[model samples]
Target: MEQLRVTNQDREHVVEHVKAAYAEGRFDELEFEDRLERAMTARTHGDLMPIMSELYGPRGVPMPRPVPPRATPARMHTGPTESPERLAASAAHGLAAIGFPIVGPLIFLLTGGKTSPYIRQHALEALNFHLTVIGASILLPITVVGVVLLPVIWVAAFVLSIAGAVSALTEGSFRYPMTLRLVK
Candidate 1:
């Protein structure tokens, strides 16, 4: 038995063909199982494409055209409404700001669902700033009162930071209240 070398593209195509053929009731159980195994083992475009072409040719199957890759957006723009991810991130930032200060609110204002590299960069910077502030408070302190206070603040910041990061990952907009307004 020859092994099928399949590219990612070819593997995808083969899977589609197998699904369609099985749906049409063209193959008996054994043959379907064999073809499915072959399709799964395919690794490269050269490998899987040929196998699919051969398998589906008898039925006059047409080859699908390759899709062009999408271009990245040049800028980030938000209108009156924002995505849920952004809102969640913003809220997390707001909550964080209560204890951690300016870092959280800044992150919320800067990062939105828009596909701008600059926005992402700023969001990261803001997150980093928040982490640094929290880290510094934990690591450095000359007074006993400051030492005791740091831990309490640290826990609050930690929770808010996690929430903010999750919101950003999910592509939601978040807003925080009572922080320095960096972006409108």
Candidate 2:
């Protein structure tokens, strides 16, 4: 089979994947920088395949292979006070409804996100959702129909923020609907 050429978008996709992998503690800083450089420089599918092979297995594989355990410095708590961490994560979502919007989640992300992946995930979700809401609030006012729906959007954002908080508290997983995910 002939090797397919890779475009800038393809390179960006791979770079993003590499970044996510690094964020998840799949590799160390040096390895991440190396992989990032390789992904950015890739010119063809063949070049990209090997970059992710260790993380996702072969190119045609349907699922990722298991990752062996590694000593990651990011994990801070193991037992006892874990519930407080969950509360903090839940608060990241709840703060959006109370008018903080961007600042609330950004605070949580900067404070605890660097230490705990769970907190980071929840904070980032909340941050992204609020950003999407803010963007909509700014752009939607230009159209008459949007002006009518503006209040509706605000209400939905409020209700959804509460729901997101509840989900983060109970399930540790909550994805806000209609989010832009601009941060990551």
Per residue, candidate 2 scores C-alpha lDDT tens digits across 45-74 of 888888868567776453453476665544
Q: In candidate 2, which residue pairs get closer than 3 Å at backbone N, Cα or C atoms, i.e. clash?
A: none
**Alpha-carbon shift of residue 136 in model 1 (angstroms):** 4.2
Question: How many collisions per candidate?
Answer: 17, 0
Identify the leading candidate in terms of TM-score. Answer: 2
What's the true lDDT of residue 50 in model 1? 52
Every model's TM-score: 0.30, 0.60
* lDDT against the true structure, each candidate: 0.54, 0.84
Model 2: CA > 4 A from native: 1-81
